[model samples]
Target: MSTTALSSSSTGSTGQPPPRRKAPRRPKPAPGTQRISPLRVIGLTVVWLFTAFNLLVLYWLIMAAFKTPLEIFREPLSLPATLFERGTPFRNFVYAWESAEFGTAFLNTVILVAVCSVVIVLVSAPAAYALSRLGVRGSGPMTAFIAIGMGVPFQTVIIPLFIAMSEIDLNNNLFGLALIYVALSLPFTVFLLTGFFRSLPDELEEAASIDGASATRTFWSIMLPLARGGLITALILNAIGLWNETLLAIVFLQENANFTLARALFTFYNAASYQSEYGGLLAGVAIIVLPMLVMYILLARRIITGLTLGAGK
Candidate 1:
């Protein structure tokens, strides 16, 4: 009876409860794996601040463009009273357009940019190709000469350039500006293209030669196609440079009618007028920069890829 009672009590106790299990421990993160350094935090903060500042400036410009002179002066940094508050913005643009013959200026700028980009591509690509692949004598010396020209400032050559242009009756002409742009862009374009060309595999050219392709045929068929990305990069860069060019345009284009948009912007503030049209000026600037912004947005991915490929090797 005593043994039976003891066994029954023990069984009851065992059935009453079981001990709880603890969860498995997670391993700690490795040292240096999840740490944020102060330097990185500071650098990121600075970048954010600069980005915010630029965005604010852009916002201000866009807002101010639609405001009248009175509204701009009264609320320089404020938002527009209403979305439809034109305040003569369109009228100002129309006036500005007619005042400077901006249509002609636009046409001239387009032609100049196109012509210069084509010329630079045509001239620089072959020169760079020869320097990189042809094993021609004096290639090094020629490259060095071109590199030396890059170090020389345009200010140093402006007087001589002007005299030469005047002598050739090339001054005050869009053709003359296009020629100047091509020359100015050549050194850097050649340098960049040479680097890209040198990075290409020589085996490709060798294969083409074995297939009975002559040197010119090999370059045209194989090499040029391979170099398309680099060529596009060069074209975009040269176009931007030609578009934003101011000093040369100012100096060469003396006639009011021949003035580029950049120079035309100066007419907004005549010393004699005393009253500067700030709203119109800002609107004009926005207009001028819009095309570049659009181009960048459209071609940003391609530009990044091309630049990365060109730089990788």
Candidate 2:
């Protein structure tokens, strides 16, 4: 009677204890795998801190450019007094541009960057096309040989380059500097663009060939247009590199009038007579840094994607 009563209670009141649930099974990793550790979290935290520190420094540098020499020293952490004014109160920019001859240097650097970057990309694209697409024997070896040039230090060649240019009477010529920049930039450019070209679909090239497109015509009309992302990234990188390049410019260039921004800024910093000139120095720095920063911000996505694509292969 007691057992019957218990069975009736289980059925009517509790509904058979609602069926016991099985615990979820954990997935096992492969035998060679190591378990995750706290190091990853620590590493990520450090990287974030470093990035924040860099941004803070950039902010301070830019803001420091707007203050007067005395005012900069007196109030290093504060914003420019002209913040309350209608327009930018960065008078030091004008002073740096005119007094420091940064205006002339800026023009020289612009010309050099534009010419060199365009030529490097143009020259590299064809070479990269040949290296990556051609089925010729020894092509792989040739690519490896070209890539080996990347490890060569500039210091090793600087003296020889200077001597060669001096012999040709092109030592101080802007065109000479452009040529040098193009040559030095080629190894990396070819290497980068080769990978990028290889990553593209071979089916496209095959179709072009099937359609009676010449090799030259196919690369020019189809591949070049499709590689715009990588091309732009290369151009921007080359421009930025050549823009701030100081050692080569200083060695190859002779005249003050021909100074690139790096050389001009170096001269400006050294020529400062008093602490009051710090503002102008910072302004000069901002002039060199701001354009690249703006370019990076605008095309950051393209740069990352293009570079990623190049590296993917």
Candidate 3:
């Protein structure tokens, strides 16, 4: 009944404190309701349509590969009867391989691509590591010069390269083509690997140095293992490009026996058109494309990962 009682009586009519005010509540949005832009909807529709069209085209190509030439045009969208009434479903493949010279061309391409890819990686990796990590003088300018080569058009050098190869008696020779590939591939390979090497941590090299490891030994033992992804990426890129390369093969290779898969396919297309053997033509096309397609599908994830490895830095 002292000061507390007097204050409570002054604040409210009774001894009790005034009622507390309730806070307002917000209404929740309806489930499954979302705002979307019309532009986004249109873009998604277009992309899905394009993807469907590509898949349809692939299906048609596969179906046509098993059909006769007449059936291919007449029943473009229909399934091949070969699937159900087949003696050997791969007759077209066999014909293309044996008669079209695809088998020999396939062998030549494998050897050339394998040798060239390895040589390109071997030559470029060390150069890239040196430019990126070693304290070499004029490394920046050298790297710029090397990068500049990538922009130079191969067309401009064709005449001179042909002349040079002819003078060396290497024209139409696989060895000469391999040399050109290695040389042309260097600029891009070195440039790409340099950035990847730069993105790697410097602490590893420092630790190796502290343990009395020489630069060469450290690179071979430590850095090389870390850079395997980049190297493999470079190798696969070169191999795929070289596999599908036609211009160089057309210009450099004259002998049918020396032809690559791409060159052979070109030749087969012409011959098959004249003979009305579209099935064999598609078979040759599949032969040229399938290996690269399979490889890409298998290594698609690895390739993407490798390309993105140093992107953050």
lDDT of each: 0.80, 0.86, 0.89
Clashes per prediction?
Answer: 0, 0, 0
For lDDT, candidate 1 versus 2, the one ahead is: 2
TM-score of 2: 0.85
True-structure lDDT of candidate 2: 0.86
Candidate closer to the true structure by TM-score (higher is better), 1 or 2: 2
lDDT of 2 by residue, 226-270 (tens): 898899999988888888789998898878888899988877887
Worst 10 residues of 1 by lDDT: 266-275
Query: Over the stretch 31-69, how does candidate 3's per-residue lDDT look in tens digits?
Result: 434367566677889999999998888788778778887
- Pairs that collide, model 1: none
Give the Cα error of residue 263 in candidate 3, in Å: 1.4
